[model samples]
Target: MDLKGKTIAILATNGFEQSELEVPRDRLKQAGATVHVISPTAGEIKGWDKKDWGRPVTVDKTLDQVSSSDYDALVLPGGQINPDLLRLEPRALSFIKEVFNAKKVVAAVCHAPWLLIETGIAKGRKMTSYKSIKTDVINAGAAWEDSAVVVDQGIITSRNPGDLEAFSAKIIEEVKEGRHVQRNAA
Candidate 1:
């Protein structure tokens, strides 16, 4: 299955988990999709690797320059700092809402689901995140599960970096399935 004309957007900021963004990006690219790193900041953003800082990833586009309509899917990579900051940006949160409303695949791993909570679209959906945010995800109305990966409607999630393989595969599968329109209003 080739994704020759597909475009996927990875929304993240400084402190994103290195592998979470890189692995899926590379995997999708290998499958022929155009992958873009869109951030609120310009230039490059540094990644978070375990207990220390990691390599910097180039930002292909800024959040202000793109919209949900420009991509087939949205990927959110988690780190304690990344999604925590992104959720506060009105534009970023709004973009998430637009993507979810459009029924596009919105995949998030680990703490990334926090952004979903901020967009008010996580309610009533089944999801999973890093253990630390279980309560937060549940409080937001999502049915949280401790699984390697979870797909609800078009929202895909995984527990942590360890689940990247499953997470990325699920994203590819969901994007290939096209739009999921049965979700409630955000």
Candidate 2:
């Protein structure tokens, strides 16, 4: 789909799954969207490959540099460490909530849904995540699914790296569709 002139934000920090961030960010940019990698840390953040540390992604904007209004969509790329660190960050969670409340699309893959849970935005949404976190997602009040990708009122989620293509495609679709009336806004 055409995303020319759209600005998307990928929020991540050290230890994020390398492919999760890279694949989707690259896909979005290629689709003609202006994608920004935002992070709590300025400069760069490390990525976690399957077994070892992978490459680092440059942070286009620090958390304090932009507001939710600055983005058309927000993406959370999960790794065991990245979301774990971000979920506890008040600024990060607040920025996510602002984006959510604005009815903008928010996408998460793998364990990234943890950020949604921490922000109280996962409650009552239909979503999916890395299998290991199924219980955590259910506990957060989401009607969990086992599909490769799930979209509920503009909040998109997927299971793992294997699902990245679909996850990224859905983000573009949702953004092209514009804002959704979030049925269960936190």
Candidate 2 per-residue C-alpha lDDT over 26-88 given as tens digits, one digit per residue, 9 for 90 to 100: 999999999999998799999999999999788999999999999999999998999999998
**Candidate 2: which stretches are off by over 4 Å?**
none
Q: Which ten residues in a row have the lowest lDDT in candidate 1?
A: 176-185
Q: What lDDT would each prediction earn against the true structure?
A: 0.92, 0.94
Error of 1 at 127 (Å): 0.6
Score candidate 1 by lDDT.
0.92
Best by lDDT: 2
Which pairs clash in the backbone of model 2? none
- Candidate 2 to truth, TM: 0.98
